[model samples]
Target: MSGKITQSNNFIYTALALIALLISASLVNVMPEGILEYIIEGFTLLTFGVCILSLRFDKAWTRFMVSIIICWLAATLLYRLFAIEMLDYLILVLMMVFFWGTFRSIARQILFVGDVDTNKVIGSIVLFLLIGLIWSIIYILIIVVSPQAFNGVDGGPWRHNLSQLTYFSFVTLTTLGYGDISPRTPFAQVMVYMEAIAGVFYMAIVVASLVSAGLSQTKNSRE
Candidate 1:
């Protein structure tokens, strides 16, 4: 049981590391654009790999999802290397599934557990980051379907657009509207508003849950 807990903690740490790397890459302008994008892509792949490892599922389901993720990752890489237009859609879909599964697993672990521990706290943070990632993919999908969904985002390679969308997603998630990236379409605006609400609600729920869990643990110890 202790070993299992340690593995879970490691998963959260890995996710946090990936989030930091992605944000750092986005903010740093010293590197050439192409090289920066390549680094970001590398981190993206690594994130997917870590997410797969972090997934908590029954054996059959685990095997199935892992197989699908592996196939999608391979196809996404091949299409990206060839500059295929499908790469954006592929990655968008892949991230949606990945974030959904990861969020569900982490939420379950944190909410259902009886004890409050470091892993639960870390999982809460991971959940927050995962929410931002999910919104980023949603933003990308909107842009893919309608290129004019956002203002201040230039029409360019999807990779560049993805990086920008990611930054925008986190900014929106944190409710730190810098006024630089605004949604032009109603659909985009709706998503941005939803993400902002989700960010607030998620934080509130996690704090409540953690506090309740901690109190329960203390009471149980006394009994």
Candidate 2:
């Protein structure tokens, strides 16, 4: 029982951290350039740390994530201090790695290893958010390489463009191409379509997981 409670708390904390990251990313537009950027980066790192903590079931896995986080943090600080464009790509790549790791961990718990409890249900939502975020990082990377990858985005620091890219990412993930932002390059187009496909299938996958969990619960109750 205590273990279950602890797992529940981890899920709740991770959920809250993800929410805060989303909010901070959304607010990047209104925030001014220099100091606020650092704050956002710090907040992002903190969210990543919380996510790593939520994976405490595996000490080795958690350690690996910490090392990635450390590398990401170092790259971020150097980018900020030196204003290096290359570091932007590095940071985005590191961020993507961490998010992908967390996404897989949460997905396994919710989809395969766990009962259909409230925490598992919330883990599904977290998985959805991770999908959006992971795609956003990919979009950001493409933009950093080819500034004209998308029609609606203007060239600037990735941080300044994060809000717009993130919005576009989720919009694409939900298959709601608002037409305000359109992917031009072949790579970007492919990613957009893939996200759309994932969005369509995500419901099917979650429903299947839930149904399986329900059946297992009924069987256990009978026993």
Candidate 3:
């Protein structure tokens, strides 16, 4: 809310998100076995778009968020229909960009919103926590309902369920692992660990940087 956003940056992000959606759709129900990267790949680009939107949420915040949802929906439909290896790899690149943009957005929000009106700040915090909590709870419920199918992880009964996969993804994202469900395959382990590291860095480096910077500035101004 404090800084100005360039239209060029927004258009770039929108373009990437849109392409990711279209590519993801093309692979629907068409990917080969042992390759479930399509979903991740699709979401990686889509989420990057969301992260970008977070930064420059000016007059078009609502519309931008809606567009993100539409992209996700399109991706989901595509993954269900076809699968593609190349597209999955492309998603990896998207994830890299997404992580960077996500942390940047968080840092900026923490910095800019600190000086805003109390009610508005509090409302934003509550809204963020609420949406995050609701999403996690529903995800956990789905995992609990069909643990076997989800935990199977080998095109078994849980291929469609995706509970275990989703669970691990969040666990790694939040850097919380209860040890009940873990990555069995080497590739899975690598993915989860990478996510955990990314989460840690985001919190420690970006979030902490914003908070500490604010504190230092406030202290200096008082002096």
Candidate 4:
């Protein structure tokens, strides 16, 4: 049972990291624009599918939340494929809720787990990437609501906009101000600072939690 659990955890973390890589690649501008969008969509769907499958549902509520995520994914894809502009806003709202739920679920699992094993370490990394993705989604939402939210982003479809924003998200999360992308609006500026702070605090908390878990495991072994 333990081996199976570890395998499942490894698969999910791998998928998460792969999705982040795909997004990063999309930002490099080397790939043909049309093909990159398709690749990103495919990988995103695959990542979400893996996340849903690998999630450890400990209660009825979590199971229900998973179902909701499935429905959100389906709706978002449909709207994107059909180019339904009005409904795309609704999709953004759903995406925010889904991402928040996912972050909460994963954070809870990591914080409450009894052992500081490889799985937990991988989970911590996944959580960090998830935070970046969540902030990216928020940046997208800001752009959607206000066209002037940010500067230096190319004018194109929403898919194209995400490529740049996703890159900017991780950059800001790591406190690496590349100066390539800047927030034009006050709200966007505030969000940028907030994400920076969140990134710092999250790292500090994860390190402390891991150290605590490791000490507890060592004490138990000595006993």
Q: Give me the candidate number with maximum TM-score.
A: 2
TM-score of 2: 0.93
Model 1: lDDT to the true structure: 0.74
TM-score of each: 0.85, 0.93, 0.40, 0.84
State each model's CA lDDT, in order: 0.74, 0.84, 0.45, 0.73
Query: Which residue runs does candidate 1 get wrong by more than 4 Å?
Result: 1-5, 24-29, 56-61, 80-82
lDDT of 4 by residue, 1-223 (tens): 3334343365355445456655554764676756775666566656655566566454654576677667767776787679777666665566567566667877887874577877778778778877887798899888877888899875456666776887899999999999999999999999999999999999999998998888988999999
Q: Give the per-residue lDDT digits (tens) of candidate 3, residues 98-169.
A: 333343344345443444333323323322322232233333334434433234443432233233454455
Q: Per-residue alpha-carbon lDDT of model 1 for 80-187, expressed as tens digits?
A: 689677775676687678677777766776874668877667778788877887888788788878889999887666656666888899899989999999999999
Q: Model 3 off-target regions past 4 Å?
A: 1-151, 154-159
Candidate 3 positional error at 66, Å: 9.7
CA shift of 171, model 3, Å: 2.2
Ranking by lDDT: 2, 1, 4, 3
Clashing pairs in 1: none
Q: How far is candidate 1 from the true structure (C-alpha RMSD, Å)?
A: 3.0
Pairwise TM-score winner, candidates 1 and 2? 2
Model 3: how far is 146 from its true place, Å? 20
RMSD to the true structure for each prediction, in A, is: 3.0, 2.3, 11.0, 3.1
